[model samples]
Target: MISVEGVAIDTRHWIGGRRVASDRTFADISPIDESFLGDIAAGTAAEVDAAVAAAREAFPAWAALSAPERGAILRRVADGIDERREDLARVETRDNGSLLRSHRRGVMPRVAMNFRFFADYAEKLAHPDMEIRGHRERVTYDPAGVTAIITPWNAPLMLATWRIGPALAAGNTVVLKPPEWAPLTASLLADIAHEAGLPAGVFNVVQGIGAEAGAALSKHPGINRLSFTGSVPTAGVIAAAAAPTIVPLSFELGGKSPLLVFDDCDLDLAVDLAVEQFDNAGQVCLGAFRILVQESIAAEFQARVVEKARGLVQGDPRDEKTDVSALVSRAHLDRVSGFVDRALADGARAILGGAAPEKGLYYPPTILADAKPGSEILTEEVFGPVLTFQTFADEDEGVRMANDTRFGLAATLVTGSPEKAERVSARLNAGTVWVNCFFVRDLGAPFGGNGKSGIGREGGTYSFDFYCDVKNTVFSPNGWKESSHG
Candidate 1:
């Protein structure tokens, strides 16, 4: 076990603002070197019962607080996260095998920002006030009771807070089911919440495999709302579990997104964007690994991308200069490698890496050209550092190729012309389209997918809409017309 900021990270469930043990525990093995990290408590339906009860009991008082009051607590939470950013970043890197530099610079900061942004947003939240046919109307958002949040392994703290921040800011008590692979930071979050003076039972974390803790949390009748971020198949399971209870669900699922490069684009920027897919070993759902380059410039772009991929440093995640690191686990590494192997057999040509390292969980930044059209490598979410090259002749062909996927979470466009960027962005079948950029995000934008990628948006007002029950009240313009009937 590792200690951060003089506190030994607890692996037990964080329920009612304290650590609670379970009957069984599972070992958390680090992907960096396969070392044993800690023993995580295996939570089950019984633990879920205790957690839901805690949240249910805490809901009334939490929701009763004024928006600013809750916002103040969240701001403190954000501050606490910032104060321990370095410690938390190290823990996250050790647990998940994501680069230390990334966690310190981007992931950890974004986790804090998720809370701060929502905190201020809650204070300024406003619904439309209107008058129609001599009737005055105003809307209010009432907090949905006990929220069940299930977060994925990739960028665990950031994603968890992305959902948790809004849930708590909207004044709903939360019980979060963090991915078993990287559950350490969540326990630390429970500590930070307590230190930040967040009331007991306000935020809870249950750490275990999805089948046990996750299924129980989603299937709980007491849960008023659920938000999950993970694979499409896991989402299907959660949807099934929640359906029986009729619980309101918000899902942010998988993506096999595309990055389109037009002939009239900045070549340097397009090449850099293509290289960015190698970030986090390409675990990003919106990484845009499928590059649809304009046929005229396709050869040049592929050559540049290959050179960049080859130069990437693959080693320990703790090293600051390491550009790539291990996949989350041996099994996941195999899964990613299997997809590449099959693609090569189906006529795809590897430009950089086509195989995994023999010793470690490391899979090099792999680029493939001429992937078969209907193959799994082109159609499925590999969720690794694997890029596929496809060429399009013109604008119409590029847009068509970009939209030719079951997933529509996000798309990237690289072009020099303003008119083309605007026109093409509108036509792309994605919830978010990036013009000359990638992974640039705003907390207030609507952030979810269109098709199998996800259901419902969860940023700014969209987040509150899902976490709260929007209610409209109508009355006569002048004090209900003095109760004319009476």
Candidate 2:
């Protein structure tokens, strides 16, 4: 049995609800210490084909069940997750280098919540009825056949379930292609679903690199819908591959989200929110890493932020007191450090950390200020514990600076005036605008991106729209009379 942190897992492809081993395997290494975790099954086109075939064969039976029946099974899955929350948390922290406390307290719990929320939502789903030209029109949703889901490495279990919950709740069978960097929890999830009484082939996981299992799943003609959460370049590749079959796609890509700090706002709150970008070692796609402060309070805000960055406890993720941890891998660390290095070379100032740690995959909490406009660091996503600081002269400039990016995933506004919050939020180009807050997610609200950040939204009914086929039937007012057959 493959194990991490005492949590024994079956590191193989789960096809037709059974453990299916692959011909090849890859090393699963820990970023915390570069320790070898285990060998995970490396999937290719063959595994993807098998999983997709399984999903297609199981679709009719799964979709034939009543929505409430499907939801009941999802609730059981949620219960299973809750029962193993601690074990799962430990395994995830060991596998991904995320803080143990965060996994135990937030990420694992949210994974369970995702299942429960979607389970309830699927049961309570109601479509609007309309009368058009004296005809009664009723809208209904039917489960799209097989769904192909590709998830990222940063928060593997949580992000996968964010899509998986809704897909299963909507009565569609799924074939998940989890990121190779953190594929352990996904294998564990397959076991949980099987224990929760999900039927064979209803949910499957194929583990491997993006070019093999991921690409095969994306281009599979058998898939009815595809949902991907990752980078923009990967999204483009997946989109291009799926274009031939014209499969419906839902994408939640990367972001360079902004947090605007105004002169009239609470300084402490602003600083606290700024420091929050480093959460998960700044691997968060929705993180407001680009901080645009008003010129009046720029000096004070920058100083306090730098001071707090210096004081953050960085070491073992297993430690409860540790506030930051390692990047997912050395390549990611190099990528992040490369962005900062280029920024510094281009005349940007590093107020805090600018160097990679002497050992381990830890890149210090870095802040780069005064990067020239249109620079790569500001335009592209570093996806690290790095922040870019700039000052805006006025509200117009603040809004403009925040909106001046190809990414519009999310934005944050800090102000004492409710009117300013309302007015500025309206003008902001982001899909979600947080007022005096960050990373507050409500399942009912739509979540995704605006431009290249993403293609569609997730959560509540928005998810159903992608996982199910919405159709309308029109009834003639005088089409039939009672007891006409008799």
Candidate 3:
């Protein structure tokens, strides 16, 4: 419905320093009502080349800036995004099907906070120790030249900004390839960065399928580092593509995380936390997908969760009181529906929701009971608002079941006893574990999984490290150091 600079922008690509339009552009339909949003231009190899070339050209100067200068610019960028928070939130809601209330209130603010966090940590990040063991020696940090940041669709702008913002603060020129499914806000983010006085080519966004544009960005020799946030299978492709170049890579992959509910925890409190953990239909990587209920209170816990889950009203995200919204697209809904069907055939009982609303792209919030560990519902990252439950015989068994999956992003533990909470928290293999709570994330904490769930850490100081390379600068006081070479 809206056009910018005469180009029809859907969730399309912005390569190099220009917006691209293609005849082969694809439609962007809002999942809320199955209405056609607009069309996005597919990016080509040439565009990728141009983006990388521009990044390459901009790298030296961007990298060479003093740490304070970079930090100041990053602060300005954060302020700019904060100024346009409401507009950014609307674009995100249109692009990702999240609630406007949550987008404007929760998502956009967190993104701005991330930028400010990076700005605050920028100077501290570059501080290197002076070594005087036997001679005057010191070390410094250096930018990794051009970085390729590939983001996902779930939390489009927020997730990508976590990578792009800090990467820029760390002084790396970036060629961003946002998910084709959710690309609009990334383009908007690029516009904001430009408007905030970021040099052209210092940051760029290209919209295209991961198979085409994403692969090209990863494989390009000019890019010294690649930061990716998506599923594991896709991460494999990116890893393979970047292999020849052997660039440093940061990957935050899939998660089939667990949440353990103990008998000591208030049943009502546990139920509320479990439902909220899946916030926007459980599509997030850190979603507590598997619920491992303690043996003593399994029945009571399941009953409370089912009651809460049953009350959810699934419809368009725009509705003021809609607790849940549609999946990203029909294709995604079909995939989720197929998973539910397979789970049922495998003998999993659907207690809450198992089908999509017939009228629109609305997929109901679902909860499955007694699903086996090997079943599709339990094993794979279903990525829908589906909760799979299993009863545990004891505390040890619950911890074992929680760590069974290959993914380990986060886990939520509900228990009243302090000692028990500590024991279980220690046993959880996930990067983040919440005791008596769920979805407790702070901007300063380091968050990422230990197992197949991820490769690198992100958040506050950790995010800055991913985008930079530490250089050892040894200062020899005696004129010049002797070389071992003949």
Candidate No. with top lDDT: 2
Candidate 2 yields a Cα-based lDDT of: 0.93
Q: Where does model 1 exceed 4 Å of error?
A: 1-7, 478-486
Clashes of each: 0, 0, 1
lDDT of 2 by residue, 1-486 (tens): 686888899988999979999999989999999899999999999999999999999999999999889989999999999999998999889888999999999999999999999999999898879998899999888999999999999999999999999999998999999989999999889999999999999999999999988999999999999999999999999999999999999999999999999999999999999999999999999999999999999999999999988999999999999999999998998899899989999999999899988889988899999899999999999999999999999999999999999999999999999999999999999989999998887997999999999999888999999999999999898859798995
Clashes of 2: 0
> For residues 295-385, could you state the per-residue lDDT of candidate 3 as single tens digits?
8888888888888887877666666687787688888888888999999888889888787667776777888887866777887888888
- Scored against the true structure, residue 123 in model 2 reaches a CA lDDT of 90
The deviation in Å at residue 343 for candidate 1 is 0.8
Off by over 4 Å in 2: none
TM-score of each: 0.97, 0.99, 0.93
The stretch of ten residues in a row with the least summed lDDT in candidate 1 is 1-10
Sort by lDDT, best first. Answer: 2, 1, 3
Q: Candidate 1 has what TM-score? A: 0.97
